[model samples]
Target: MKNTTDKQLLRRATAVHRDMLKQAEKFGVSASQYDVTKLLHTSESGKVKVLIDATERLAIAIAKRRRIIICEK
Candidate 1:
């Protein structure tokens, strides 16, 4: 079995972190408000599914950015 360790990424020197946060906030609002509201009128299941998918997509976007930073370093 391989050992699991937490490798930390430093963020102090990253540019556009604030901008990314703003974009993430906007994504959260869109997922929580617009997407859910549009589907909620039809089915609860659809709302939940969309919410989960949006969360995953948001996480992936953030992860991609972090990977880019790590690679840069």
Candidate 2:
């Protein structure tokens, strides 16, 4: 169960994260560059694996200066 405050915090965190990502992109940094800046240096193994996969794609986009769209079916 989630409360209104919890939902608000989640929205705020997401907005901040998005801004950070945009700044990273503007500065020509890959999303992986901010991975080390995560609140904790650790995450669940499965989540970490997902992050690693997304980071790889972000690295490629940064290297090529092209956008990559990930799709979920």
Candidate 3:
């Protein structure tokens, strides 16, 4: 049997991943504002950094939720 704590963490991770996907779609809606030509000239590092930040935020949110679950348990 899977440990309750492990199962809880898995569920939390899945939920956060879904939320991140929704957030990504929301962010994609604003892509029309960028000039493709100018964007092509911009460094990829900037885009990578933004993705990293979003990922980090999602991770932090998941960790916080997990902590809450542990406290409740």
lDDT of 2 at 35: 55
Per-candidate local distance difference test: 0.43, 0.50, 0.47
Q: How many backbone clashes does candidate 3 have?
A: 0
- The alpha-carbon deviation from the true structure for residue 50 of candidate 2, after best TM-score superposition, in angstroms, is 12
Better of 2 and 3 by lDDT: 2
Across 1-73, the per-residue lDDT of candidate 3 in tens digits comes to 1467655654554455456655545444222222122342355334433444555665555566657767988
Q: Which candidate leads in TM-score?
A: 2
Question: What's each prediction's TM-score?
Answer: 0.41, 0.43, 0.40
lDDT of 1 by residue, 1-73 (tens): 1222211111221123334445656544332332233443565233444544554565577666667767989
lDDT of 2 by residue, 1-73 (tens): 1567655654554455556567557747666554533643454233334444445555555545534322221
Q: Which should have the higher lDDT, number 1 or number 3?
A: 3
Q: Is candidate 1 or 2 superior in lDDT?
A: 2
What is the lDDT for 59 in model 2? 54
Specify the poorest-scoring 10-residue window by lDDT in model 3. 29-38
Q: After superposition, how far is residue 23 of candidate 3 from its true place, in Å?
A: 14
User: Against the true structure, candidate 3 has what lDDT?
Assistant: 0.47
Cα miss at 14, model 3 (Å)? 16
- Where does model 2 exceed 4 Å of error? 32-73
